[model samples]
Target: MTGKSLADYQKEYERIIFFDQPRKDILLEGLQTEMEKQFKLPMRSKEWKKENQKIIAMYRKIVITRTL
Candidate 1:
């Protein structure tokens, strides 16, 4: 193997998962916008909105970690 550390390898893996792959940004943006409209509040200020963001972020983390 090369001289890179394990953490460096892990970072590369995560980068591939989170950044190298194609994502449906437009769909995600539309969904988030619709959710904000439906809630009538910014996601950071509303309890339900905050919860949804947490859930979405968790899912994103899981997907990236697993895919990596």
Candidate 2:
């Protein structure tokens, strides 16, 4: 309502959708549904070693997007 334009709000909307993490509950729900449709991924690999760097990266994106 200040000096902001529609373009400013549009960019903010995109940032919130893309950068901000969703609630954990929503994330879990989406993961469950999407998992069924997903084929084997570089994420859920059978050859994962103890390091698990790839798995951790995927987890960070899904559940650890923001600190609580």
* TM-score versus the correct structure, for each prediction: 0.32, 0.27
Tens digits of per-residue lDDT for model 1 on 1-68? 33443344334444444443235343334334443354344435556546666444533443444422
Q: Which pairs of residues clash in candidate 2, taking residues 3 or more apart in a chain or in different chains?
A: none
User: Which segments of model 2 are wrong by more than 4 Å?
Assistant: 1-29, 32-49, 66-68
**Residue 52, candidate 2: C-alpha displacement in angstroms:** 2.1
> What lDDT does the true structure give each of the candidates?
0.43, 0.42
lDDT (Cα, tens digit) per residue for candidate 2, span 1-35: 34433344334334444543445445444553343
TM-score of 2: 0.27
Most accurate candidate by lDDT? 1
Which 10-residue window of candidate 2 scores lowest in summed lDDT? 32-41
Worst 10 residues of 1 by lDDT: 20-29
